[model samples]
Target: MLPQDLITEILLRLPVKSLLRFKCVSKQWLSLISDTHFRHHHRHASSGVILCRRTDIIHHVSLAGSNSDYQPFTSLCFIDDSAGVKILQSSHGLLLCCSNYKLGKARSYYICNPSTKKYSILPEPDYVSVSDNSSVYLVFNPTKSLHYRVACVRMCSSSFNSYQVEIYSSETRDWRSSGSPFAAPFDMVFDSGVLWNAAIHRISPTGASLCFDINQERLGAMPGLPSNEKWSRRRLRYFGESGGRLHLIEIYGCSTQFQVFEMDMDYSSWVPRYNVDIAPVVDTFPEMLRNCIVRNDFVLYAFSLLCLQEDEDDSLLLLHIPGQFVSYSLRNRTFKVLNSISTESNNAFQIGCFHAYQFMETLADADQYL
Candidate 1:
């Protein structure tokens, strides 16, 4: 047998399932498996998938790549049936689920490692307001640090004078004020901010703008959208992060196309990344999808995944269709249907609940943060 030190090294690099099984080899192994240091090492070994809840079931798919064979994937969700909002965000392999139930009368959030089925419910924040739109974001990366923090941002648009920032620290096991940094307003309805380069980039009600830095625990402004661009409400515009860079995606124009831009590391400029024409793409795919484009009234929602290292042609765009996920290649110009995602019913409301977020798998436990 290898020496215990050597075995520990090997175990740390093993897959989650194997590590969990190795716990049964002996009490010593079990203790090592549960050690904080071991979990940290294991987190570095595995990168997680985006978890999407389909009604009661959770489906986790690779952040990039097409489901050419229609292989199915499903993970059990421990969420209470009464839960609402169903917003899923990930940081350091842990998923932060912010939900509003009881008809906006109450708010509850959960942090869980879906791989291990270990979860912890967070105490309600002090600023739980009558407005259901309280802003929250997660900041945790095992590679960079062991600690995790959640930030809730509120803007006093009445004046560009200041914004309220509250932070929840795992070490403190409670939420505290990080103080007002700047005056900014985020249109939660249109802007789904993403954490990149240690800051939460949000936008104004007008469309592509940036604000909030959870790590800095303050609000701030960002450069304006690319010069001479018309941000029409007729089109759907959203922001996403992939491969360590932030992206702005605009889907509009009479051509029914998608315009994607990648932000520079310095956050000072934008570069055209991909220009996808959906009409030709629909002609190349299934009848149902083709009809979505031909009918002219069908709505499209997409979840962006990083450009996969293996697929050179393009970044993967996961189309949010009822009861299924369709992967569209930005470069190679291909489309594949994801059959692994199965819905219990075809109800439009239930289908609308299916939202996807990129999850980076890590061994970080929610308990350690507290």
Candidate 2:
């Protein structure tokens, strides 16, 4: 048998691609790599996105081993259909993809580990859209637990003009519904089992930004906004994570400047944090606006057109810039350009919306190997 020290040394150096494949070598290696402690070590050793751009293809990028020099990594493509993929949320190695076509009627949800090329399909959701509630909102946190539970909130008709929420536990693989005294069509964001439900009241052309919590399967309102009407009037956007904290990014519909607010540990209030801005002209890029994702320290905004000069193919040039990823530092109050991603081919299909989840890896024991 190889010495444990040697095993650790070798595994630590394996690229994420090799490591993903080795996960199935045995349950033991999977547990070691998936462990939170191990992930932190790897994260520091391997900074930057391990994944990017969802076209007819999906790509994974990793930092060169302990090297500061920029090393263009290998790209892996999953080209099944021209259908593009959107990453909703990610944890560990598994990615949840919501693949919908034709007005999202024949939508398909999948849990895939691109590294291993292994995927599982989730059964179609069956929630009756009865009464005034027109749509169902689903949020997932794969990092919450080993089994990766998917939580959902449904808008159902009620006599008192209130909305109802339903919870689903992937561990139990079941959905249970409950009623909330609150009203309908609220915006939602989730971290682990904690659900943030924000009321959407139209302010002129904008919406109100009041939020509530639904943890332990119970609902309650969050604290009030601190900024003046100017702040509240701005579009209240729910950004998944900012500087390692759950945050809400508030931006004026007509302005380039935006504010960031962190979720209070008490889950009772939103503490105003940082400010950011992009060139208003940047909004023209549809990709930048539509399917952006936030990482531990970066905010990725999509751009629509890529432009090239002279022999400039307008289409290629329009997509040339691909997308811009901005990494912000809360401590320094500064931003840095992270990287750019592009579609391998414009022939790639387009998606309206995507559902994402990152599997919260758990320690594996001899008895619990899958």
TM-score of 2: 0.57
Q: Which residue pairs collide in model 1, if any?
A: 48-361, 72-340, 170-369
Candidate 1 to truth, TM? 0.77
lDDT of 1 by residue, 307-338 (tens): 23212334676664434456667776667765
Task: Kindly give the stretch of ten consecutive residues in candidate 1 with the minimal lDDT sum.
Answer: 302-311
Please give the CA lDDT of all the candidate structures: 0.60, 0.42
Q: Per-residue lDDT for 197 in model 1?
A: 76
Stretches of candidate 1 off by over 4 Å are 3-14, 43-55, 63-85, 103-105, 125-131, 155-162, 185-191, 227-229, 277-280, 286-290, 293-314, 321-324, 331-335, 343-353
TM-score of each: 0.77, 0.57
Best by TM-score: 1
lDDT agreement of model 1 with the native: 0.60
Alpha carbon lDDT of residue 369, candidate 2?
13
